[model samples]
Target chain A: MDETIRTILAEHGHLPVEVAKIGDEDDLYQAGMTSHASVNVMLALEDEFDVEFPEVMLRKSTFESVAAIRVALGELTGS
Target chain B: MSDAGLFRDELVAAGLLVLTGTDGIYGRSSVYEDIVAAVDGLAVGAALAEGAVSYRFPPVMPRQVFEQTGYLSSFPDLMGSVSTFTGNNADHRKLMDVAQAGGDWTALLQAAGANLCPAACHPLYPTLAGTLPEGGRRFDVAGWCYRHEPSVDPARMQAFRMHELVYVGDAAGATEHRDRWLQLGVDVLASLGLEVQTVVANDPFFGRVGRILADNQRAETLKFEIVTPISSAEHPTAIGSSNCHLDHFGEPFGIETADGGVAHSCCFGFGLDRITLALLRTHGMDPGDWPAAARDRLWA
Candidate 1:
């Protein structure tokens, strides 16, 4: 569980440090991610996890933290 | 449509200063300023109703950031980069030697790590991501947009103005909002007497998938634009675009609502320069004798 969480964070953590926890819900924009950083993280997550992000999930509220993104991906892929 | 020749004559009669030059820049005259002021007044008036605050963005951006955004991959045809050298006289002479020999001189000098911003959205994303609210939100923005299209037409320039109506809501809501604005936008242009047509468009993302994506976009009707013929009477020019970004931005910014849901986002952008071109074509360049209705809508 820890490794999987770290992997996810490694792929999506572009915001400033300690912004949130692996499984805790936090705001991505509020936590300090810039728009350019957010785009990089999104493209990275898609590449690393081999998942295509749906058009509906592309907003500031979705990439709040690892937990939120994981929840979004799980729902999208039904994993 | 107004007669093109008569419109030119009106432009002359109005004493609108026109400077014909071989250098690419055009339409920076007193009349152009008048047009910009009029458009800005209308935008500010509309914004007051929505409680949107004003913002200004710079015209340049970080090079690495742009590369990460796929700009280099997509718009190599239109993107320009800043370049510089750091060495002393010896290094400068070495660079000149390569240039004199006609070798790979460009590779010798380091890229300046800066890029000319092609659109207003480039800077906006950073600002939005920096100061986004707890839930989803919206913004009304106006910025000078730039593109290096290889054309001498006065209508098509390296720099122009863009007015954007942006909304950050849930996915369904964002899509609906964009559609609503598309219809309203048509009425706004028609009220000024410009003949326009709405068509699907793509921002030309990079690579093979980009081509497929653009094609599928048209097939699926994911994007649409308001266009009219100005630069060319045959192929219409895009005056405004209503874009639905689905989750592309949501996944990046982490913008969510109280229910722990990722908000969907949409934006509608009007190319003020292109719109001016359309208006010039439709209403005639001389504002002095413009249709009484159009004048009242503008000056008043």
Candidate 2:
């Protein structure tokens, strides 16, 4: 699951650094992921996970890290 | 009806504005124009002293260029695309029949391949599609900006003059420009005796996805508006705003910084019509009754 998330980030995050370099708890926005890129990343994550992020999940902190994304995905997918 | 609606009615009764049968559209009187011009002068003067060049664009821009600005996806509710009667003779006859019957004739019209200028600085981005100079570029861009909102609120005009200082270059320059102009906005409004409060604000992004966008924007502290009591003290209207669009325009417009990176952009815009109204509300409806200090900042 983590590897899949990393793959999606690599394809859509548009971060200055590679996903392999980003740890599970690393701050994605701090690593240069823009708001534009963040939207794309969110869409791609939804596509990959087959889950929909709720209105309450629409925040900077929800997508702040790989661990955070996993937790959000877990809640939606009932992992 | 809001207090602004009553105030708008008063302005119309006072011969300051001509009603055009539209909620947010009106014709400005010479006196109204004078005050708007004075406000424009004050804003332009601030940017000019900092060596900002003056650039002007028409109220309409090519739809192709406007599509790249992400305005359609971001603020689709406010976006206005120009359409015209491009059909053949048969379609024209149909349109005429509909118009004569007081029916919807606009459905027959096709895209005019143009869009109403959403903001003064939007049309300026495409013109800066190359590498900028060492320090960057700054301009005082002005145009008749259009938003599709029709309201009785006098401050929320459908068509209004947006006079802004737009800066494009490195991230530092972009952020600094927004910061500086935000302070100037507070000072400028207060200097005119308007009780101003500068606060973090967000654009009215549309749709479910737009909720996330708005949240992200507010979280970034990228936009600030100088609010004043035009309608009421509790619900002050924003007369001016300073925004930092960090590489949002540069990446799409192909604008590069002097140091060979995606350029960042920022804008400090004054809603001229709203500012004029704020002045009227703050000092009396009559410009002649305005204080000497406020008059000197504008008329002088």
- By DockQ, the best candidate is 2
Error of 1 at B148 (Å): 2.6
Error of 1 at B159 (Å): 1.7
For residues B93-210, what per-residue lDDT tens digits would candidate 2 score against the true structure?
A: 8999999999999888889999999999998889899999998999999889999899888888999998999999999999999999989888888898888888999888886677
**B168, model 2: CA deviation in Å?**
1.1
Give each model's whole-structure lDDT: 0.67, 0.90
Worst 10 residues of 1 chain B by lDDT: B1-10
Task: Note the chain A TM-score of all models in turn.
Answer: 0.71, 0.96
Question: Candidate 2 chain B: minimum summed lDDT over ten consecutive residues — where?
Answer: B205-214
Off by over 4 Å in 2: none
TM match of model 1 to true structure:
0.68
Best by lDDT: 2
Q: DockQ, per-model, please?
A: 0.04, 0.69
